[model samples]
Target: MSRNTFRQASLALSIATGLAALSLGAQAQVQEHSQAQRASAFSKAQGHIESFRGRSLSDADHSFEARDLVVDEDGAEHARFDRRYKGLKVLGGDLIVHSGRQGALQSLRQTLNRQLQIDTSPKLRAAEANRIALQQHGGELLSKQPELMIYARGDLPALAWDVRSFQTKADGTPSEMHIIVDAQNGRVLEAWDDIHTAAANGTGKTLYSGNVLLTTNSVSGGYELRDPSRGNTYTINMANRTSGGSILKDSDNSWGNNATSDSTSAATDAQFGTAVTWDYYKNVHGRMGIANDGKGAYNRVHYSRNYNNAYWSDSCFCMTYGDGDGTSLRPLVSLDVAGHEMTHGVTSRTANLTYSGESGGLNEATSDIFGTMVEFYAANANDSGDYLIGEKIMIGRSFMRSMIKPSADGASADCWYAGVGNLDVHYSSGVANHLFFILAEGTNSPLGASPTCVAGNTRVATGNASLSGIGRTAAAKIWYRALTTKMTSATNYAGARAATLAAAAELTATLGSDYSAQVAAAWSAVGVN
Candidate 1:
């Protein structure tokens, strides 16, 4: 059973209703008063909706609905809202409203600034749009009907159809592709996969993290690999199938002997990884679960024969792991790998960064940053914390990616460039990975030496050639804050720099030091400015 219980309650605020005949200052004060009296952050934002919208509140054609809510340590609240025009979802028309501790408006960031003037009437039929999308996708339709949405990401808005389809990739990985087709011409606007895989390439024969502890639920007959404490997050044996699996059970409470020969060994590692990741987010970030709701996600192990990947699917709201070919990889259940996959779910719930281009690179980098944080938080002696990702899963290679100097992997980029977005998301992610490492550990740390793009002659120097880290805890807090509150779907490398700097500014009081300068320097060091 999957515990994806996160839900967004619609606000009853009327778009056409005008505020009382009072000065803007007085009206804002009244809104602030109402916000302080509210219970949850969403409700608080609901009370201040008019103030949040500013001049846009007068636009009766549009309405805003809360998508996510984040409350910071200093009683600051950030609420993300998705815009709808004439009851139709407006793609890329999402915004976040930041409010200070006393409910005063701080700032607002939005993906789209253009006014909506598109005709709702579609010239092409939904079936025709689906056909066009299917022609491009070549996959089974996940939904029978396509939803009509206002596409606002481009220079002008247009009515479009959002189509979802599923297909197995050539590498045996599953793809849940979302395609946006124009209703006016049936032309494909954008397409991306929702099933975020751990690594594009490929995991091994044993439990890499030795003697890890797991929390399982007790049945009348025996104990099952289910965590009652963490949203009933459980692990199941997929039996080498693409879909459906059985929850692992044990006559005795003990699991796996650390050998891949026994199926439970991989399950044990998967369960342990999940538990540690869940704890890391909760203990460090104060997030309750993957979706910040008290619900648990499930895990599927031993998926497909000789399968070489692991991924997190929002549709299934569970993590799926593959048993490797045994020659190259064994089982893809390393702790950092688990953290990386689960953070994708967190990204989906928060920023929902577009899974392509620079935004996609940030999405991947967010996972890598948190994955490293989870490793350090776990502090497992068996699997020591390091900047290397998927180190335990690789056979011949040392690791999948290295954060200290991303270019060490040969394929990943060490720093950002003008056309860096053209690279694959995994390779483009190197820029941000290097930034996070330098921000947290500095240039010449124990992890490894990191070179600036200026030193590499890739770009001219814009800021400090060297940086002093503000430390990992502070860096993680800033990144997490930026990801949840400041970032939108289309935020690019420069936008990421701005978001992190803003995050650092907000965290100054708690962090007891202003790291905004260091954050900017680190981004500049990676040529993001």
Candidate 2:
């Protein structure tokens, strides 16, 4: 089937599910409560625009709209808002306002550190901006409409046109490229792709995890590989194609023998991986699903013939895995990999960290951190929990990455440098990966020995030669809180330090330990201070 046809079918299925869900009284009440909460949060944020803006600007010049509302465990409300100046969207003017349960304002965090005082009118025409962006893109234009918005991510804010283009890689991976063009000067300010992949080098099968229990939905004829308990999250077979696959169905609920020849084996791995990742977030972090909306995201297995990578797409709200070449790598459906890819969706909903530079590194590290945690959470004897990522899928290598010492990958950085952000995000992610390892397991852990920047003679800073860990549970909680509450789209290494420190301080009472010092020391050990 054609890609467009499959997408249409998926949409129809979703619509039908929505209609069926709405017919139920319980689902109706849940929908109503969600809407009511959104409305209330929006109204509360709208009333505090002036206070959040923190400026003397006229209210008419600026307006606020809530994009998402997250209620913390402590009854604190964090409302993320998109800003508009003079009826034009401000790209980097998004902010999150934290409020007490009593509706009292606590604090505000924004992407734009400075006030918006730039001219609204663009000197260049939209058509010219589009042409410039297309010239730089050199690909098919997916979105022809060049939206005019105030770009404030840099040192100075400027009117810009956001253009998106599309292209496919040799391995059948899709790329949705975004180009931010300065409307005043017709310069391509920035460009990035929407598709976030698992590995830079495409590489991945079997009933690798052995016999495992799966949650399947019973249909009229047979049982489908769908988990009704978890928002009906299901797995589909891609038939070695880039797009359009059928849902896996079985005569009985039992799935997969310990072999790779059976197609259902890969499906079993994918389904099991998704289930464990979902449970990890729900039980450990209080996250219902990827978007924390009590909804599940589907998974696509056998994405393409000999394809060696997996990725998460926000546009489809789904995860796609690839069957490996059966040489260096096997299937890319390992438990840690599943957790890593799904965490990308969580990061998108929370920090929405830009996928470039230092923020990009942090984004990758966040996935690696949580991915490892998810693996440990499972405690599967077939696939034992370890800090090494992709160990189960790798055929020759010991693992894809090591959180204990990221430098074991031969490319990842163990310590942060001044120009570390210039490196590829996957490699630069080592700094945070190492920091998390040190924070969770200390410098001399039984798993592996982690060295500090000072021990490595990378920097002469105030760092502990031997640092004690605060345990994985406490460490993961601190990082999760920082990611969901304090971090922003433009957050860098320094911002991450501040966010984690704040999160550690906030949880000190509950943890019964002052993790703030350990968090700070971890950052300093990684040369982030």
Candidate 3:
């Protein structure tokens, strides 16, 4: 999804033979490509592949198989292809070729090393690898089968075993982590968490937002609190359980009381927030649903006894909100909170930004940005739109994070610095949050009683005069395009800068003024340059 332009070059075919073969398994079906498709693919991909590797792609030495052909709304086509060498899957060898409207090559993204040489034969047995993975994860084994595959880590490709096992942390949190063990020397290469949970610490006062419309269904017993318009989204009461929450049944569609004593009141807010978030994306960004697949996600309220946080899980395709300790915070079903959590689902489906490092920072900021946008779109009288995050939850605290001045939260940085990516994702998100505020409301400008660009947060001056906003509409559109079309898993602050600039260029193609310049100026204002 980056804007790295690829140059066309003539490619020559060369032959290389005698290599270990791969156990195709279920992926064998995708390896077959028709002659017509192969020719068309090669014609469009040759230039991109050569440009990315800075060498000619030999058909005899490598095999290219088309996996997915997608044409976006802008008429920009993206073709994903898998690479093979000597009948063996090139491990992480995958490339995405982007073509312009006229079918001309635009750019390419490759995950494999151009020159790969490694022994594919495993020395350690699969049983030993599984035992090692079990010891590392937890001592419990969930599945007995282990998959033997080539594990590629940046330029180093090695024969490895991918082992999966169940684990419970010291805090009693259930999880599953994939441990990649080197088959050659039996060394652990890497490990990653596969479990997705909305980790808030513990739900109900009254309905936070006032009376709002909800789409419900007429069931056999009574009207069910389900949204028919927005992917049939529904809310259930967990009754303080970790799983298997019961569906709430109401005699009438009207739910919630103005006060916390009623359990249904909290659900009123969760359901309303989901509906508003859905409308915001559809009405403003032309997105169909969370996954852009026209399907709704369910919500589980009252999750766990005294749980204090809310989260969106892609694994469950649902959102879970916790009832806060009544003395500290209210239910986590506030409008902005719902928007923030659901945005995680959107990020998961789109860029799938890695949940650590600089990309993780961007991932969190994306949620905050859209969450704020959803609030603005809602514009409810009781809970008006503002840049303040978690405003309703922290009761007396007023707000959690401020988009106008991210460092106001004490831990967040207002500007970027060297090694800034090493900070926590929540704190590192300040850089992007600051840039977005400047883009939407301008520095030194006042937005709805809240003055823009307060001096409390540390920021590098642009030397240029205060900015004039491109408006939230333009800002959101540019960001969405950058995220969905120009970002990769490893994209960092620099990559984000490039991606946003490219997005602005595409958006303001026919504009007289330079929109990309404003994008760069905003980034520089936050010390990104």
Candidate 4:
């Protein structure tokens, strides 16, 4: 059990024991104290409860002080607060304070502090407040221990805290702890322990710290290898999600209690590319990092032994990429590849389009579009704004999925016309990618229209089906709007058509676009409209 858990359980047990003792025989319990001691605490506790039976606001502010009140039957003076509540009268302790809105809470806290005796109000030491929470509801605390609670003063959120699910490194260990703190008053509110574990341990959830085996060499900054000469390994340095900014240091990259080796060149490439991708999203879209919720996750490069794929796991809340057959070819850490995988996170948070059928295809297309945009956004001359997918990371004889011509990657369908969903997401995304290219460059000569692959997924007659190129600027705006607003749980090509229209209309409402028609034609070119 964690320290907080033990603490909360302790408080609850104590409260129960106290209540049971009080009910057993009031006179015997306070036999050493005065009659005043026998009367007030229990009576006051009862009053506090009754007052909370959903009263109104106008009648809520209740304050009082009982003189020489028998705190323990010796007539010891303990402060008293009576809430003749309008809404909830029996409100006390942490939850009551945190649950209140910001403005009213300030008033309420002051009211509580003034009404209750300052000495008896549970003034926790700053160190104790570090992770202890004390909660009293209906005049009874929850844990057996009165001193320490599950809610130590932190984790209180602004009125906008969203309830989230968290998993932990397998071992049946809890991943997240619930502690409610008053944002306004900075007081402990209420908290609960999240009980979950890692997958590898069966009882616990495995936290895969994407650190792959690495070999140290004087040259190439030491690359990642499965069985390098010196048994070296490097871990994917995780980007801190809860905290803001970046921590670039030796301690940050230390993997598995071992010294850092920079992992594979691909890992370094992927990490750097993702960092760039993160910066691009923030710069262009004004997004709050990755999830647009002011949160960004880390990328684990060199994921398994010779693993040849990349995927995002919602359960882990992170992305994992495999090295190319444990060789130099398929590096997921490539620039476009990094952008591609990172975009999956954005799609998950926004559209949440499922990974099957047409929605899957659209989802893949969304990734490709954003991935390409990130590449261009960075203006990295080494990796220009091209329709090609994985130019640097060679898979087989060619790069991973080719957007210019899906068939070039030995998979994807170059243009959308129907039956796009029948293929893989990477290939199926061609239609949308083509449309994006059109939106950016218009019909005559598309921007970065490298070489076209066999348009076999839907139609093979490929001769530069020039969309009334609305330009990538317009395409990006339409995509952002559609993903954020118009899309839902199962977004597909048809959905994309409608969403883009709606997005265009919204844009038209604001920007007054002759550009919307251009967007429509681009969508129509690929069969969305």
Candidate 5:
């Protein structure tokens, strides 16, 4: 199942009003303390449903299962519970209890509109719902019937069929689409991709990474470049077609000549990139695999004629890349590109940040952040670590986004604003990307090369105070912790700030107050306050 985040209450009224009325240092202290209290409550997570329902949700039915608990830095607690009625799961039925330092009930956040009441029996058959779902995704139907679910779409509850279906693309990249069909009316209420494909490199004298050893399979007649050592991560050639391209075969195990003229060279790069990325996540973060399942995802290179984009599909459980038009771009299989796409799989398995609004921006930024880290981890001479993304993709500029100065991309934002959530997720991601750069390297890095802030065209300092670097290691740890533990599916920038601050508090004991200070500064720099 994809990981999801729950919503939390915003900053208290008094705290929000005090920032403008209070002195600068005092305001920082107050905001820090308030954020700490919230984080503390979020971390403790020991709030009981009885206590929560008693004080805040008095009218709520007590049929609930405690799902998660969190305590903030000030020892406050926030408890999350899912409602179940008559042994059936209540869809969209969730409640959160906020408690003070002494475990006193403070507030509650509830998604249940009212006591649910609806007919459980369906007028439509499961087979009909299944057919409707298959039609919704435009994919071939499978034999299995849809599963019955108690669905609530922000209104009256009803029985629904959670239909699962799959779509195999012309290039053999597969994806699963899930549709929620009304059990009584068979209306398609909601549909989402079970496997997300959104847009990787390597080598044995490969196109990107040079002179690397490869693991292969000795097939019936020839050798295939399929690795058995690292979760069977292999590569195939799409043969410039949309579907059903045969796998590239080699007489000898040796592959590639560091050029795209030979398809094997591109495949070599894909294989090497996958290996390095897998090793980086495993060795550095100690994550067993993308999903922590020890299984490997494959790569499909040369997808379609002059296809400029690449995407990672969860349904196919692999990364698909396109060869550029040979003029504006080359193959999409660059090292950082591989890291970026694979991180999408990791995101899907973890927080599963919703692909809309601020959460969507966070999702994109997480991929960029981890992708950059992966590049840094590799430290390959062919593709050196840098803040620039897809530098090897384009011919002239050699960059997709610059984390240090996101505004340099022209479309990306440098700071948060009132309508930022409305911007494209790729552009909205600039805020977090800027914050990451400032946090890891600082405003004026020790190397004397740091990004300058801008309010449109005017230059400005990043935050209220001069910031210091916490280094990438500490910053990555805090981010990983927050993404995995503190964040949910619907978490936004405000929630992200809370989560990161909570992570900072947890890190203080081990990494020192300096690290925490820099984290706060970085967020403040990006106008997160």
Candidate 6:
């Protein structure tokens, strides 16, 4: 609900047609306009329409069929002709005139466009708009709790545009209606609605709650889980930590190093990124905050100017974003960035791997794995995406990080080897990214897996640890369990192997019975064993 403002604005004048040009005839009209009985009836009707623009009319009041009506000095308009839909808000009343829809609608669009100063008609009606807003809004919800914003979306489906909005429903998830609305005009131009149609024969719900978001804390921006007893394993806390300062401050007592950077845009990026990501995670994932136990984490965005990267500092338990060159080449602080950065939080919560050598590689891999998953789930427009990373924040459409082809980044490797962890954290991430990519998707033999890693084991540690390929989906599931259930402080590749096996074992217990062979096979495919 929004407050109504009473302001005097002139209504665009239009000449009345036929009887609209005549004087009042009915006694009701004459009695109301006793002093102006000789005036044109159209003039009386216009006055009635103008009277109720900004003010609310009684549900029983049926006055005139106000059309092309403009608000008067009181900023109110009254609609009494259509009592059938009078109680309906926003779309209520008989203001709709189909005959003049073309001109009036076009003019209304023009009016709103001029008022909001926006073009391309992205006004909640465009397909991409829904995507971006979701990235910014829903994505934030999810960062806090993966289960909160439980993604009912798949690799996002293309949105179809309607008259005032883009509308459509995704393929798999029966929980949501993909929609963008022109808030100004109360029109839906783009929509992926989940409302089941008797004819289309569909049934589903869009979200747990469409209007409200639950926060864990009373903190100005923090959000809590809606249901504390859900399958959450941690109490997740979300802080709009958009800078090193904020990140350092957020997790003062947490068990992680603070990733520090001096980038200027880092703070801003982090702030927005954190808000949206946390919300996305919280709403979609249905978990508490990042830790899932309701512990609040801080975020810091703009640390320094001209800085070109973003990172999650485990030591500090905070996330930071950077401004990369003038083009905003910063790494991880976008909707996907937030999702990726915080997935590190999720990984840390679950995996707790060391940030160096094999463990460090595992940590990086964990971030990329969930990060990509979050992106697919979000289905946002500003970042409606692929498995690519840093698409918008970095080099235009190019991905700064790629699990399928780590070499594409010229920094990360596509597959893990015995000594791959010896590299820097950024580079060490290549192996896990590769592992995740394969785990989520599949082998490169299909030609779509970006074959830049043609060098094979050349990027691996100097060992004969050659790896085959495990399908991406199986790999991701195994890793998710490993990080969330069995990982410990002394985590290493061997530890990861053991923990993941245990996680796999535990998963199999609930799922069926046997996953030992598959888990072992997956690890070998990533060259882990």
RMSD values, in order shown: 9.7, 5.8, 12.7, 22.7, 13.2, 27.3
Q: Positional deviation of 485 in candidate 4, in angstroms?
A: 0.6
Q: Which ten residues in a row have the lowest lDDT in candidate 3?
A: 8-17
Candidate 2 residue 274 C-alpha distance from true site, Å = 1.4
lDDT of 1 at 20: 16
User: In candidate 1, how many Å is residue 308 off?
Assistant: 0.6
**lDDT string, candidate 2, 427-495, tens digits:** 778888999999999998898888778644342223447988999999999999889888887788988
Q: What TM-score does structure 5 among the candidates reach?
A: 0.69
Q: In model 1, what lDDT does residue 451 have?
A: 78
For model 5 the local lDDT of residue 326 reads 75
| Per-residue lDDT of candidate 1, residues 299-375 (tens digit) | 99999998889998998898899988877776888888899999999999889898888898999999999988888
Per-residue accuracy of model 5 over 308-372 as CA lDDT, tens digit each: 66788776788888887777678888888888889888877666665556877888899889889
Candidate with more favorable, higher lDDT: 2 or 6: 2
- TM-score-superior candidate, 2 or 5: 2
lDDT of 6: 0.41
> Which candidate has the highest lDDT of all?
1
Clashing pairs in 2: 204-329, 204-330, 204-331, 205-331
Which lDDT tens digits does candidate 6 get at residues 1-529?
1112212111111111111111113323423442232133335444433444333232332243322221212222211122122222121122311112122211100000101111222233334444444643242111221110111111221122222222222321112333333433433333322221100000000111011111111122332221111111112212322222322112111111112232222333343344445544444433345765444466544434444555555555655444345553533455566667777777555434445456566666676666666665544444554676656565554666766667776666555656675676667777666655544454543524433233346663222333344444445566765564345323556667676676566456444555666556545555566
List the candidates' TM-scores in order: 0.89, 0.89, 0.77, 0.50, 0.69, 0.45
Off by over 4 Å in 5: 1-203, 218-222, 446-465, 509-514
lDDT of each: 0.80, 0.78, 0.68, 0.45, 0.68, 0.41
Error of 4 at 265 (Å): 4.2
Model 3 ranges off by over 4 Å: 1-74, 78-96, 110-206, 448-465, 509-513
